[model samples]
Target: MNGGLIMKEVTNSDPFTIVGTEQYNMVSKMNREYRIFVSKPSEKPPASGYPVIYLLDGNSIFGTVVEAIRIQSKRPEKTGIVPAIVVGIGYPTEAPFSPHRFYDYTMAQTDQEMPFKPDGKPWPKQGGASEFLSFIEEELKPKIHQTLKVDSNKQTIFGHSLGGLFVLYTLFTSPRSFQSYIAGSPSLHWNERNILAKERSFMARLEREAIHAKLLIGIGELEKEHKSNIGELAKKMSERLSFYKNRGLNVKFIQFEDECHTSVLPPLINKSLRFSLHSQVDQ
Candidate 1:
């Protein structure tokens, strides 16, 4: 995690590359090459430097996120959104998504941990969440901190779907890793809700350590319409939201109307930016 991340400079030759953004490739300790995209605010940084947001599925959404930040943060006084650095963790592939993501975004599992599969098909090679997280904390963050003017205290992580699952996993397992978390349409039903098993430990840890962090979860209105093997995810999401709030966690849940799982991401992205970057984040 600490030593094996080797940064290699990449020239942005792609025609779709966003202006004012830089792309690079880094080899993780697992020897997996990841494409990293970064967009820095043009405005001068504050004394404590700008906040940072680490985005998953960067290849598909980096441009949207960068443009949103640039436009919204241009008039911070009016938008109530401050300038921030955006770090996109993607793969070294021309495709919008990489198959390798199935490994990076899931937790280590066993026969007992995941007793059944909804799809009834074998899952792709997975169980690398711990290593992937180490790549972020030990290899990636330090590199970013050393090279950029970012406020370590104001870090946030954003992910959607499986990546969203990773966001929640990070929060529950290592709450101090970031100040805020944005999970858009997370796959909570994965492996028969195995992720929920960790909730009790997370709550206990929060109480024992008196640690505080903010969470924002968003899902599309039509998510419940599509039936899964387990049940209606929209209801499940609501139930989990209530459970989190009841436990005295700083959390927010939003349901985007007139959208499905994929379509919800755009609005969710806009809201996520505000939720994470706004000065009054605790509210």
Candidate 2:
């Protein structure tokens, strides 16, 4: 393994330790630095323009999802998936994930959601989701759209765990921000089911402004233990989705068999991608 050192050539664009992709460090006014990756498909985009998937936790899942899209989309006659651009929203850090993800990929909270240490130590700061969402809407989206000729009407966003929570939050608040939303094993118990309130508010918005988008909610069958909150969380999500499905939101629920919370992501990426783009390219 060359003593854990990379023996291959490296470049600034390949900073994510992956090839065939470009990485950039974007600094925001909120003092958060995002390590972004743009992975374009190998084949030429359709005349309708290429679809784009904005991924949270870019540093960890970017490579997996990007490669999945590339491989699956290679043979459309066999795999229904299509080649699309993947925009990963990661942070600059040697670790697998940055501490800032706790804050940036969460909903605004009031209480009952703080993470405390065993000895009751101060938890990491959180609840900066609004700001992070603004960064994506104002700064990141414009930058990406300006550079690439993307099919904005086919935009998709994928997130896992806490990032999944953020995906739901974004969908509820600004449904048009993306055409499809995939939330994998979301931490819905966060803030004592605070996301429900957001959904309630979104219901009111739906009355005034209609939304047309696809939503995929997936969770590992083994994600819940005896005392786990995942079951209740999923119930709330499913119930809420029931109300929105008739209002233009096409939703799907998947329970991955024989997979746990952490192990489900790699496998879910491919399925999520297909679900996200199926309707767009099926015609």
Q: Estimate each model's TM-score.
A: 0.86, 0.88
For candidate 1, write residues 1-283 as lDDT tens digits: 4489877779676566566789999998879999999998888899999999999999999889999989999888888788899999999998989989889998766544443457786667778888999999999999999989999889999999888888988988888899988988887666334577666678666556665578888888788676652225534644654455544456777888988889998899899888889877634
- Model 2 ranges with Cα > 4 A deviation: 1-19, 113-115, 226-228, 280-283
Q: What is the lDDT of residue 180 in candidate 1?
A: 89
The C-alpha local distance difference test score for the whole of candidate 2 amounts to 0.82
Task: State in Å the error of residue 248, model 1.
Answer: 7.2
Instruction: Score candidate 1 by lDDT.
Output: 0.82
Total clashes, candidate 2?
0
Per-residue lDDT over 174-263 for candidate 2, one digit per residue giving the tens place of the 0 to 100 score: 898999889998888775457888888888887776689888888887887624577458656766786776678877778788888788
